[model samples]
Target: MRKLKIGYIPMFRGTARGDREILERISKELTDLSRTMDFDLKIGSEIVFGYDTAVKAVAEMNSFDPDFTFLGSYGATIGSAMIPMDKLKGLIGLWAVPEWELTGRLPLNAFCGSMINAGMLAKFHTEKHIPFKWFYGYTDDPLFIDRFKVTFQALKAIVALQESRIGLIGPVVDGFDYMLVRESSIYDLYGATVDRHHSVEEVIKRAKDQSEAAVKDELAAILAEGSKTCMVDDEAMNRFARLSLALSDLARDNGLNAISMSCWTNIEFNYGNAPCSAISRLNNKGIIAGCEADIDGAIGMIISRAMADADAATMCDLVSVDRADDSLNIWHCGPAAGCLANKCGVKWDHHFDMGHYEGDEWHGYGVVADLTFKPGDITLSRISTEAKELTAFGATMFDKESYQGCSGWIKDYRMGGKPMTLAELLSVIYNNRVDHHMSFAYGNFESSLIEFANWKGISVAKNTGYVDHMELGTLGK
Candidate 1:
């Protein structure tokens, strides 16, 4: 997880009595909390008590370039809080402390100040909007701490997306037109860069150029891990190691935080090997990798990783729905990280779908990791084409056998705080026209994902069952 930088703006009215001491105490509490939190807090050198002081304080805070700013409403005038609220680039937090005492002449009308500031900012930001969150209660309050932590987690995920550089190794697969996304739209929406100059041939050439010793060492390490190797022989494993090393080098050479590859007919037909193992290896190493050149899927994996504090995320297809058992099966051509494998462990085997191809040589594409996902709470998410929207849901993986390849059975799915039946979930997918691929991590991140979408202004689809309005007029009543 990335550590966030937070700027603190302490506000006070110059004429108000006893505000200086209260502001100082608030600063001390925040500074102490920062030590325990996963963020760095930068407090202004002096409190803002007037317009000129507010301007100077804004300059000082802006120099820190915080990912989020906290405005301590310590009996401050609306004008003072407005300076940082308008000047800061990211989300601003309005923190109002409880009154110090109920006795004579209210020492600090902090809550009233915060309400006035919120009203003023809301009116001023009608045209050019700035996101802000409200907080009440003292720093030691449990509710305050919980909200603060959740916001921090959401901001960290947002920052990760803004800083990501994704490399697309090839075009989307032949029939998967739905995976296509405009690179410019991705940048405009998520602040992530998409580099498409790298080609499939480059990866192949790099794989071939790897030194024999390095390939042998990688193969040895993989074999030493005790995964049962099925039809795949030592040569096939060696080929997978070379490709894995090549992909790793490609990401490093291009400075990519994530990669999406076609990983299909071209690589399988020409290179005589599939990249499922390579994708798994890269994901395990914290370099997010997606199969079939799904750029949005790769971005979703990156978001999952960030939300889950860098846990490896897997991209899988919703293969089947079992109504009797109330479960859904998620599977892919063996690209899941080793850490997600069940106690049965990973199995190196042939790609299940390659046998349908015509040639005898196609049978040699035997290097996929076959395993079941370990039982845990899982969060599934996806970004739509053109980066226009996002969807996320929470489910629990059942501790039961799954079909061949990297797969899992998930039950008890919920979205938008509502428990969804299997039919309802299917309806949501159909109505929304969600992509076939969804990325998942080993934790419940529904709230974090929603928060991230809110922060970025990305639409969140919380579909429940089917929508009557979605029917065509000619086909419906």
Candidate 2:
């Protein structure tokens, strides 16, 4: 179980009727939930002191370094000083339901609306460049608990994967912010580091130092393996092969495990056009590399690599990712053996740049492992911003046999679950919410993911298979 750093503030909890006594009652209730759920509750009240609870809350919020922070009832209504908002990883607001007795003396909805204020906190998070989620409702509600636990666990995995370092060489295409996640959020939450990001000039400078003989030697092995080598012609192949050598050497020297490189420079440098076929070769080394130098998609490669380390899984773009459970079709152009564990005929795993359309240098090499768990429970995961961190965790998968990617059924198949399927899990991941993500690991890790979730204060849940919307659609008609 991962030890959770949960944020909570003391001071006041309920309406100011024997305030300390009311707070004590609420604390006891929260304690009960913690004990029952086996969560490590890090309360703000214990850390925050004196006349202002808001100041105390923010202080506690920073100190606890929580995966998620639960703003107790009163803390919301009478906020003291402002929280940096950047400091928080994620947010959860607890609203005490209004009973006749509880509301008669205090404005129930007004305070509940304050719980809504946490949404504003999320807004502030957005503007201030913080990644967070505003989770609200009665803490004891089973629905809330169920979703909350699952979310926290998933959030943890997302953040952890983000903390991962993906070396970016050269430039990415324009207007591609999705590939570049916020640097601060990852650093704050998951200890994610970007390491060294280089440009084409750097690669060229490195390439110049390498002897042509060494470059030729590397290309010899690559050429021997690729039939595409003959089809691509020599002019294009020479430049890419040299680039591949430089990249491999740089990766080894810098201790980089993964990379995303832009292949357009060959044309820009007047060296003829070459797809980033080099990325395919890197993928064979089990080092993930993306074409177009897209960093956003590189995170997916990160997810796949992490999954491969733990389970029988693969990483792929949503295009090749089929939502149907029976067969999640993952394919790559270069490596025949990259997607399969055991294969025949020379058993060669090679890389080549796909995404080519007749004459373009933007092609990429992709590697996909079949990321479906058949028969029993399998966890799906990705590293995304969670409570301002890059966390990773398991997610629900659709049934094994009923899936296929032939049609656009990925989205269709994803629509019907209670955040249990791959689609449902990703549906709510938004600006204020966490990223849509999952980590599918083999076996029933409900216990482990949840145990680690609670210990780390991450969200956790049992994996329910995908919902069958077609059946529901038929019923609706």
Taking every candidate in turn, the Cα RMSD to the unseen true structure, in Å, is 2.9, 11.2
- How well does model 1 score by local distance difference test? 0.82
TM-score of 1: 0.93
Clashes of each: 0, 54
TM-score of 2: 0.47
Clashes of 2: 54
**TM-score winner among the candidates?**
1
lDDT of each: 0.82, 0.46
Off by over 4 Å in 1: 14-18, 80-84, 102-104, 226-228, 356-364, 385-387, 465-477
What is the lDDT, from 0 to 100, of the residue 243 in candidate 1?
A: 95
Q: Pick the candidate with the highest lDDT.
A: 1
